[model samples]
Target: MNNILTLAAIYRQSLFYFAIRAMTILEPQTKLSRNWHQKAIAYQLMQCFLGLCRRLIINQPPKTLKTHLVSISYVAWLLMHDPSLRIAIICYDEALASTQLRKIRQLLRSKWYMALAPATRIRKDKDTETLFETTAGGEVRALSVQGGITGHGFDVIIIDDPQKASLAHSETERRHLEELYASAIANRWRNPAKGVLIVVMQRLHVDDFTAYLLRLRKDTVHLNIPAVAPVDMTFHLDDDEVYRFREGELLEPERLSDVVLEELRTAQGEVHFQAQYMQAPVKTGGCPINPAWFRTYTELPKYDYRIISIDPAFTENGGDFSAALVCDVVGDDVYLVHGEQVQCDYPNLLRWIETLDKTWKPDLFLIEAIGAGKGIWGLLRERDFHHVGTIETHNGLPKLRRMEIVSPMIEAGRVFVPANAEWARQFLRLIGSFPYGPSDDWPDALSQLLIRLRDACMRAGQHRCRRFPPDPPPQQTSLRYGMHYRKYWL
Candidate 1:
């Protein structure tokens, strides 16, 4: 009897030990496997329950027992210590939330749990799948991100897998969850000072809920554990305990072997694999141009030709920015000298264009024919601006496809940008984030310049510039003539 009591005392003290024992009782069919990552996660969760960390975010690979450790065992452990604690477990959907709640209830109701923490009994009148209460007034509510929690409040909120991987690409779905967090979920804490908010999930998008929360809360305690270690580092779990991870080490070699990881990588593709397993999400639809591919220049080199490319937006407010890039073509390389993106009306946009032209003194001006581009082109011509031309895109080619066509030049170190320019930083960010980013105006304008430059070089019989064959010429009738009898078509 004394030995059993001692074991129960130990279980109540250490969450990690309690998790091992509880998981055995809950899942008797599967053999329990131990890993240090589990201990690391439990330690952080314990910190949250103790009020050491108010906001916590844990980003890890999928199916590594994140939900089991965080949603089930942690909730039950918290109740064991204080049955009056009100907790909420939230998931992407009601089904997931209910599933987690059921597991917690099972663990609480087990004979082993009854022996260890008999005081944390479920109230007979308040037992349900989605919500239940203890005899001491402790409440556990299960909810989906789409559900409402207006009338109730929680002392501890656990958001587990609040985003579905398949729907991560849908902007509407991502925005809806973000809006819910900002407006509803963030304000539902019972005690603002003592409440805890914990988020645990695999990364799905660059702008997913995890990213959104981190941006809003700079003091959030982030525990990022990838399936495979990208570098050798030491994680200080506690004052005396530290987990040292070596480079290229598998997070759990027993379950997720190198062979299995390879298979998953092949099945999920590079973009999904990097996001889900590595916990480093890139741009959606696979970023065509890698940011590291572009060469950097501190000063402009001697250039033979210079042109300005513009991608204009129709609206002056609450829409895409009117973007322009001034590029210099020196021999076979293209140097991005200056760039700007602003939200303004047509008159201001025209003035901005005139300013760029006069400052740079470019040999040609290539403006996209869509949106406000035609208006800008006609007005520039009326103003007698030299070497003005409108770029006509092929009907069948999409923006993504056009970017893919010009990516080789960037990858070959033929594209250059200022090393320390603020505008260059913004330009690279938009280019790197591409379709997944908020705006594509910068990339669109840059792609127009590269495509046109490539075509011109091909026409001049530059063998080194023939990375891709030029698109068949557009019909002469479809061509838009410019001043000085010059021809312009893309």
Candidate 2:
């Protein structure tokens, strides 16, 4: 045994060679770089982005933490290059969209990004199109997502993230978002060379807009760089639980964690996730007044209403959606039961409304006598709505005053919405979108309907007008000194 003296003595003396071999298999540098333990690729991308922003004022992208930097960087990158891009980044919620904008501002203010500027350099030549003015005679500007955002003929269309707070599973919400894009965002692009649409988003659901685009823009490049990269670069894991091989496979409910899972299973679950990350075409979130509030999610008996409210927009392109809201007077409350948002030529809208009326079987039709709505109203008057017999006509009210009248009803939780995310989003966002500017069409139309209804109710002594009820029949017939007084009444 002693004579054999295993490699314990001789080989032990060459332990350094074994150590070197081990180093080859597990290198510290590789772990630090590849293991995400040190400055990983994500960090480098950040560095390059910050480097680009450090000096240019307009170049300074919004500064979000490492978590949100990816999407933020993409938007910042676009804004820095060309400021004329009038984009409607439709998201599920106003809070989230506003947050994104603020973050972009924060990135610009970061010490790292601000350093790119020359000491004596200053921004100049500022206008809507020329957003940024480099210290060396340059400028930058912005285009809002509201009414005037269109007609910019933007050279670039960056859809960093659309939709507000959303659920992936809600069908109603999904439809509303599709409407926004088809009606609003689609018209915004008039440039012949129409700038490329750059979208960066997380996977929300199967039918989410991301998936929609995956199918829609088959020719365009799709780049999805998630938080983590797994083995087999060609295929990636979706979240933690599910394996996604197909380009458009949505992250399933079981794959996500419990919190998100909870949101997934609820009535709002599908709508929320779909809009939040999956980029599902969804209505705006926080819509205190959702069209769904007027609808039945489950099969139930619906009673006929005295009138059906409809508001329509005019113009061939760059027009608001034509809306048809159905309501019945129940006691003092107006039960708005169902509605539709249509974008069609004049004839088509009239035809469709008549068809919808037949299907819904409402008692009568009440339409806004303004703009495109007047066309439908006129058409309905000429053709007769299915010869149902009843017809009521009304004009739009002051937009702001109308909203003020309805706000109380929303705050009191009296108005029921079908839980539409995009509708709610546009409803809420539009109110605050412009201090003194145009708004999302649905809200304006909705306000008009409520105002018209309230007026009708007030005249009938049914609904107490939220804003101004008629002064009680000149109660007491007050006769002031020197004032004209009727001989008998006074």
Candidate 3:
């Protein structure tokens, strides 16, 4: 009886202990892999259960037992401590939610768990695959982000991977999730002030649901544990305990060795690996346009040709800004001499364009013939800027494809940016972040300039400069270079 009581005491005190025992009960044949990262996760979950932290966000790599620690063991442990505490488990889909809830139900029904939490008995009358209630009024419910929880309320809400990784790029899906949280899920808390909300998932996109929550709530305790440590760091687990990881250290080297991680990185592109494994969606290491590929120039060389490219926003009050880049092409090398983005009205935009044209005295001015570009083109033409031309629409290629077309120029060590300019730093960041980054105006302008340069070189019968992929087949519209400019076709 004394040993039984001591075991119970240890289980109650340490979530790590409880988890290990529960894992044994759940997977009797499988051997357990012990790691400090697991202990760190368990500690954070314990803090959430104890109400020490009401809002918790856990971002980690896949297959790290995030679901086991958070959705399964944590739910069972919560019921053990307080039989009357209501809980809800949310997942990306209904099937996933049901599976997680079923696991928790299995734990609650296990003989080992019964011996530990004698008071928490599952009520047979209300038992289902997705939901089950304890006799003491405590209930566990499974919900999906798409499913309705109109009348349901819970003391604790655990959302596991609210969005699927495949659908992470869909702005519509992302917006729907944000709206759902604001309108529904957030308000379902039984106790507004006391209810705990825990979100656990791998990072998918720069503006994913995790990012949304972080932006919305200031007090959220974000525990971002990357698969490999990017730098040496120390984590305070408790007053007496701290876990330290050296730079380039694996989170769990035994389970996920350096060899395995490299294979995964190769199989999955750098962008996916960085977001899912490193928890860095917009890091330059993941981007197709690598920062290392760009050569920085301190002194300008005599340029054979100079041109200014512009990507304009529709309105001053809009999210996007009017971006312009002054690019100088000397033989095979394209140098980014100057770049700027600003939120301004048409008059201001026109003035900015005129200023850039006057300052650079480029041979040609290329403006994307969309939104504010059309107005800017008309205004520039009226101002007697004869060198100006509009970049023809109807390319049928997306922004990403356009960037990909010009990436070869950058990778070939032919692209240059000013070494010490502040705008250059911002330009590199914008391009490096690419499709995941907040703004693609700079990338757009840069790609346009590169495309134009490539097309001009090809037209001039310079086969050496034809390194990039051929332009897409021409559409219905073909116009003169100075009037309504279109990409030159062979």
Candidate 4:
């Protein structure tokens, strides 16, 4: 009679049911709120389980129990249905991977779970923290993102927060992880055509792995849920059902009240809050200088001096980019002639400098005296490039502060740039998003040029500065200012 009762109580078919039941055991003390986000994720996982979604990406605010829902409860649920499902959960490191593994192991041993699925039991001989198997042939593996997955093929691979928040901004780390996923995780599926890959994490940067995968694969389904809805977003769960969120609506108001969110927004700053909680990663605009302040020029005016400022990459690896800006300074107006940023080794960097020097024939060259810059500067001197000069440092002020000192000059229209140059768009984007943009090579070079120019002019007693005529009403939004404008020449 007890065996029949246990078999009758088993709810092994529905992942949502199993997740809710497991949640009661995992988060025993807290009052868990089953919100819309959970339902949406459950549906998406169900689709993956049913062989509908091959590649799934979940982008949501952090501290929302995503790992629990997708990695632990969901995996346990899947095992109950098909104990033969080979699963691997990958995280930033072994510790994180093991943490989730422990949770799933605990949930599997809970009395509620045993009562529901009495037939499913973890094999005692194969039981371990990071790897385990069930009596019915299912297996679960936990490993780090950088760890190798040799001789192992998984039916469903779940990558939970594959990157640490601190390292997400590093291009080298991002690239390494992206390559790791492509070479290691993505190809480890037992069946290439029918295998499932699910990634769940908060959006870190615009160029992070999540963005990279979305760009590389066109068919991947992306589900994004922000803390507060920015617009009326209709999430199509299926042909008949939809999860619609009205503008300004909170994702889980019952648990994360508006007051709590507002406090977070205040404490963390709007830029961070938007990226970390709203899932809308934006390059915040507290930059000391605005790109709109610099006037555009159609043709170069007479120039007394041509100068090129170089900010060399810190490493030989293809990580930080080497940037060079060519400028023509006539009186007080500094015209930006050209700019370029490229990932190159020291040899390529030296070749690039020699080429720019030969082509532009700038009278002066200013290079930052740190990292690879110092070596490049020495090489230029050894090669008899007498124009090269190291930029003077100011008592170790932050980059933002150094940029701040030049903000007034930029805002006063002392800098003139080509109106429709192809490179100008990229330069302006970097400047507009200054200090926060993906790369700082351009901004650093530009700032170095301006500061050196100002100091040179002041020392030479060339006090007269030419201000370009007022720009005509813009015909279209200027890419630099997020609005259109017409160009003017002095």
Candidate 5:
């Protein structure tokens, strides 16, 4: 073991070696596991910590040992190389900052660390928990982002989890933190050009510090490690080094295996899981349709009725998408066969609907009677589309209200989604965010489909269609209705 340590000490140029060695001594319970995600993070963090890179932003899932390696252990590694390198650590609060300070202190006390950096000794004079100094004129100060460091400057600064999760969606709090980062924290470097800054945290919102920094600092190196890899994006560590993963590859399965991650997704639900574990936080709540309530089907059941639901855009541009969902109703259950959200003019939308009708051969074409949707209904009626129907929007209620009326059918496990469809992921994202999402077209289209199914079933005396209002008769003539299909009787 001594000989191995001697060799490791000689080969301490690699940050991975340094991190594992430090962890081995300081955190004995942590077994040495060679996770690729950790290795990539350590390398990039070391580059920034060593002043090779000016800034680095790492957005990874929580409990991935992010704070342990990047914030706590790396500071000790820096001291080993240059004991006089001044460092400052900032977190959401002073208590959290002190926790990291204690971890660093523990590492510095390890016998292994003593052998690695024999010249570095704690300055007996300033050896407090939150603020400490080494004999070589260097110091590590731990403070919160709001904690004033008026006269202090650091050679390397680490902002670890600066934004608290509780205040993630508060606009005022988020903006205030951004202001402090720009004015107070960003400028407090001893040497501006040579100083290093590292940000490590899970994504809590779309406008969190990570997003703000990336938008402002285009040159900042970013490492976004989602729990499940979304696509084939490569992490360009350097010129010759890159880390690539398949579409659904798990980031760190050894520590967070597929089974474990699935449990997390189930426990946290889609909204929280996407933000905390998936690193794709959006500004939204539980949304209208809870993804957990969506029943998935590997194969479709026999259906007596089918409809192509449409929510048309108001214009060719600068409006919501012209969304559509092809649905099949079998008994009490409604199955979503296909779904899409696209931007197109009336002509294009007509063509797209024609293609869907040809493919699905739905019994009726159910179009929402509102805005540009009125035009769609008119065109379909004029063209004599077989089995075309115009469903009236109740009192011109908001799309949100319409969606709420049909959300319970989904929650009751009466709506089944195609398990193998490529559109499933996008559909889940849209429904998970609902009205707060960028576009409400997809969910609206879904609501239209489910409402039509339920209303039709209710008229036939089927108790399965418990929610929603009565379905209005489909308009038979284009010349009968005006621009806005107002109900005459009501």
Candidate 6:
């Protein structure tokens, strides 16, 4: 939040001094670690500042293109030679990766490394086709990320910015990256000493694969240098930029952003671009609801009232989780109470619901009608679901209408949600994407249930007279009555 213009001016005043300050952090050894050559870009950027730490004063010329290419080529070569070493050279886009690959080819083609060059044409390997080897017995391969190609047991995993299907501000793509870490990419390291993994990319995310490595790996390294870092510090932020929605945008901010950001509809416009460039906190801008609202309004006593809401996806291949959440409502806050799930069709799912009705003793039961909603409602009616029964059964609220009402309540501090439940976490991820993907199915159900409850309160005044109370049991006739038909006939 510093005055960016002033910081820029100060940066201009002593960029050399700042670079000197940056270099002072890393102490150099007469001989650097051999494997250090293979560290990622951000780690290399950190080295420029480390030189400042030296007791003797020494100045080096400004870094050049050759310096960067040489560092990259040096690392690429080691990664290729090292067996089971996983290397990722991710660029901002496929074009960037391809361009970097060409750079690698150039390095290999260089006469200096003639000893390592292949003897003849290298054969491409795929689908048990005739095996091809590098001229020097090495292997070179490339795959377009958009092709959705996957390789296993990779001696070296060279990925240059393997970005596809709309990079930058895509939460879906980000989620895919997380899954790749948990299921696909991380699974590659099946052995204890399987391989060394390296990721080279700009700081696109704080939760990216790179960030994941930064947190988990002991040998992780990073290098991040903006185009204007040498001459300016608040180098990215400028006056025209008002809202930020991406990393690049957050890097630069105008002096008056605080005053301006408080009042703008940048939601549909350049908000995404600015966020990327400036690196503004995505948590604040992208969240559908504010934490303060939940904090202030949340007064639910621990595990109080049970709330049961369901999500019903029509088909299995739809790639969705048909979920149910049981929430406990206390004074004003909410807690996850219980959950029910079924993967099959209507009859079984209905039986599952009936069992839940019996077990949880839910005060109210909400069933989502997005897919087989009508049939489900009919089945429940046929099963003799009574309003006064142990648990009341109600139709689900419309998903869109529900979101419209509940979203603001969430933002205004009138709603509270538990964070511990698997359902809640899933709900948050889907809500973060809003109407973007299939995962939204679960949150849609919860939102609809709450909205229907609100509408029920509105109809309270008109309900009493029109509401047909459950019929009274048939009256008993006494033999003493005038007719006395039962006794006389006997």
Tens digits of per-residue lDDT for model 3, 272-370: 778899998873323567878899999999885677899987568868988988887776788899998999887788888878877887767899777
> Between the candidate structures 1 and 4, which one is better when assessed by lDDT?
1
- After superposing all C-alphas onto the true structure, candidate 2 shows an RMSD in angstroms of 18.8
Estimate candidate 4's alpha-carbon lDDT, on a 0 to 1 scale.
0.78
lDDT of 2 by residue, 353-374 (tens): 7787767665555565545555
Residue 403 accuracy (lDDT) in model 5: 66
Q: Give lDDT per model, in order.
A: 0.83, 0.42, 0.81, 0.78, 0.77, 0.41
Global fold similarity of model 1 (TM-score): 0.60
Task: Estimate, for each residue in 358-477, the C-alpha lDDT of model 6 and write its tens digit.
Answer: 777655456654356656766676665532111122333233434544554355343556546565555565666666545666666667655554444345433211222233222312
Per-residue lDDT tens digits for candidate 4, residues 241-328, read 8888999999988767899997776545455567679887765236966788889999888786677999988456568888999998
Which 10-residue window in model 1 sums to the lowest lDDT? 477-486
Model 3: colliding residue pairs: none
Candidate with more favorable, higher lDDT: 2 or 6: 2
Better of 1 and 5 by lDDT: 1
In order of listing, the candidates' clash counts read: 0, 61, 0, 7, 0, 54
Across residues 1-490, which tens digit of lDDT does each residue of candidate 5 receive? 9997776565357666777777776678978777778778877876775567888888899988888888887888888888998899889888888988888888888777787789888888988878889999899989887675543789989989998775666667789998898789888889998889899999988788898999988899988889888888777544478878779998877778899987766545455578889899866534656787998999887875677888888557677788888877676677888898778877888898888877887667788777777878888877867367877775555666566566656665778888878798788888888878887888888877766665666565646542323443444222322222221111
Model 3 lDDT at residue 332: 74
Alpha carbon lDDT of residue 321, candidate 3? 85
Off by over 4 Å in 1: 285-490
* TM-score of every candidate relative to the true structure: 0.60, 0.32, 0.61, 0.59, 0.59, 0.33
Ranking by lDDT: 1, 3, 4, 5, 2, 6
Cα distance off (Å), candidate 6, residue 205: 4.6
* For model 6, the run of ten residues with the poorest summed lDDT: 53-62
lDDT of 1 by residue, 1-490 (tens): 9999899998998888898998888888877799888889888988887778999999999889899899999999999999999999889888999999999999999999887887899999998889999999999999987676543779999999998776676667789998898888888988888889999999988888889999998989999998899998677666589999999999999889999998777545566788899999987466788898889999898875678898987667788898889988776788999998889887788888889977988767899776678777888877877477776774546787578667767776789999999999988888999868989999999888888877766665654442333343433222233222212222
